[model samples]
Target: MSGPLSSLRVLDFSTLLPGPYATMLLADMGAEVLRIEAPDRVDLTKVMPPFDGTFSTAFSYLTRGKETLSLNLKEDGAADRIKELVKDYDVVVEQFRPGVMDRLGIGYETLKAINPALIYCSITGYGQTGPYRDRAGHDINYLSIAGVSSHCGRADSGPPPMGIEIADVAGGSHHAVMGILAAVIQRQQTGEGQFVDISMTDAAFALNAMSGAACLAGGIEQKPETGLLNGGSFYDYYQTRDDRWLSVGSLEPQFSARLCDTLGLSEMKGLALSQKPADQNALKEAIAGKVREKDLAEWQSIFAEQDACVEPVLTISEAAEHPQLKARGMVIEVDRGDGELQRQLGCPIRFV
Candidate 1:
């Protein structure tokens, strides 16, 4: 309770990653968050593997700096308890289905009557309205429905399974935080609260960004391995002799020139800038062949001082120990309320 949002109080009715992550960010920035959980229900994060003591490491990390209250919203006076709490809490974040909160008698309008300045944010897969509003979905489904998976990954292999939950985190959690903060600002101006609806699929569609603009306005459909950044040029991951990968993003003329010279394929520098499929393929193949000649460590040593945007694709453990991330304080130790500290990922935002 010591950062920029120290004045704010949040009542979190979210269980899994999306809602919890949003609230976690707020908590990290010094918002006092109270997580309301049902006594009979079990959050999957609590039982997932890699436990520090009794609780999962992820649960400890996501719920960091937040207090928990076991309140069965189905009980006789549960809604009353929430209504009473809303008078003091500044915000409410929930991730249940569209009508579930209403059925429980703690929906936005019901609580807004008690506290007109309360910012109520709802996070869901498809949104409050739409054909798929009530449909259950995970990260992959949202990405696919939003057309994100269509233009990613190799065309022959289709979209590869993502290592991270992009739709859940980037779409649902991030959009929920943005919407809630925007509503909070609006409340400061108008002295009235509003319902912020966040749809993961909708956010994922918006994540299309440049590609979406090209497809909609320019009438150019983007395809896998065709875009400038999406593996169309030599700006892709190439495997090393040690089976490790190195990401090469030498797209600009100067960087590509340095990269080609470093790889001893200086003749292919012009091909690196080509938009034609044949030329790009030739350059990519040449770089890949040359890169495979050395192990990751050898290449790392060779390019250690180079400024060509060539770097190894480190594993999670490797990334944790990397000098840059270490310098930036991405990994941190959090108090576990028992005089012991648990190592966790730190919040990325740097409030100067």
Candidate 2:
């Protein structure tokens, strides 16, 4: 089926993960996204590994439905060509440091003057204007500054870094997409376009608001794996006898009781323990011992018969092949020339 954004035309001038991911979402929903690449610069996709020998799987996954256009903005007439294209486009997305676009003479101000109805979005580390606006940073740097890294990992271990580019994708790409969509809605009423300045640091802070609230409320300085949601006795991942993993989320009193009952730990029912260090550690260990008694599938069956909010953790490949995922079409395959098929995470929205 055609999508709501089918008629929207997007000019994507950003590169790497965040910008590409944002535009990829739009393209999946049928927006016409034209990716602008520099003619002289080697596509970083070529350098990054996990390549299928000829092209980067990462690049293929991100740029599936978008058209590629090579242009040298510094070359004569190239800037003018881009200006012409921008006039006809509904949205423009770019991810450069604060002054880089302005120096190039193609910043939002310059473009909006020509296309008054354009939704121009700029995604950056700090923001367009700030004390750290000129500072160079990446996903890790942004997350560290946002205080997100403070609450990650175990208490004994230093705050472990995230495996994925949380700030780049969650903070930058998702935030930029949200701003662009909001801008589109606002334009419908005001009959004029506006600039969207998205700061990766601000986005990361927003994502970490729940943890921030705990700190603000004078809740114990969130030690990793100790918070309500992190991994307490009632809510944690357990290793089964077969070495598979099962995740339990029985936080509420009723649910926690149900979990204990399901495991035949009736003696531990209605159990209340102090949040003190020693008490908490003992409780976590007691629960872990019970969970390790069975295989993951056995735990899955047990939880299925109860409302304990428990589940077996699946690997990426296993998740892709899962019945629920397949039924919902959450994993899709795209054909990329030469009889090659590429699989990727599918569009999350269901229009029903």
Candidate 3:
């Protein structure tokens, strides 16, 4: 059967991660996406590492099941061509700084005039009218400004390094999809499309929900490595004897009891949620001592039949091939557009 969004048509003018990723979700649900680009100014991701005969692995994964067209916006009569094209496209997604699209004569207002029912979405760093709207920023910058990185990392160390772009994927792409779908729903009622302004900084800052509560409710700024979920409590990752890491998430009292009992540290059961630095450190050290006694594999195996949420921290390749993940069909192969197939993370949502 055709996917849920098979009837939708998307004109994607964004490049790189955020916009492409949002449109990729649409494509996965069977939306017809036309990735518009300038011939000279290609999407930066197209040149990213691990190429499949010049097609970037990252780009291939992002642009799966989509059509591409190169049109120089600055070319003569290009604006008219886009105007005519927008007449048929249901949704338009762009990632240019605030006024760039207006200058290119394809701004939301101009397109809205052409297609009054068009759902236009703009994903940017700071947003349309902010002082930093015109400023250039990326994932790390967004995370930093949004107070997300501030709460991340260890007590003495700075923000822990991230293996992936959280701000781009979670903040920008997710919010864009949500906004687009919401707008689509609203349009069904009003028959008039709306504009969605998605700021990576705004979306990332919203992620500060758990910590922001501490600040907003009582002006309590969450210091680095202090909150329960932010490396404060005994819930944390420990390095194993083999140098690999294991995530320790024995948060509930029962789980904590089970973990402590398994580690022969019954004394740590009471200190699982301790706020006292001394107590927390003592419990952490005790857990660390036990964790270091065994390799990650051994620790994982020991916890396999237990209630505690301890598991080995796998590398990207390891995670991709993990039996549990495979059992859920979270990983799947897609054509690389070159007869070769590549394994990439599949969509998590399921209709059934």
- C-alpha RMSD for every candidate: 0.9, 2.0, 1.2
Query: For each predicted model, how many residue pairs clash, with residues at least 3 apart or on different chains?
Result: 0, 0, 0
Candidate 1: tens digits of C-alpha lDDT, residues 1-352: 7999999999999998999999999999999999998899999999999888768998999999999999999999999999999999999999999999999999988999999999999999999999999999999999999999999999789998899999999999989989988998888899999999999999999999999999999998988999998887788999999999999998889999999999999998889878899999999999999999999999999999999999999988899999999999999999876778998998998998
The regions of model 3 sitting more than 4 angstroms off are none
Candidate 2: how large is its RMSD?
Answer: 2.0
Decoy 1 TM-score against native: 0.98
Query: What TM-score would candidate 2 get against the native?
Result: 0.93
Off by over 4 Å in 1: none
Candidate 3: residue 73 Cα off by (Å) = 1.0
lDDT of 2 by residue, 112-171 (tens): 999999998988899989799989898989998998887777667857778899999999
Each prediction's TM-score against the native? 0.98, 0.93, 0.97
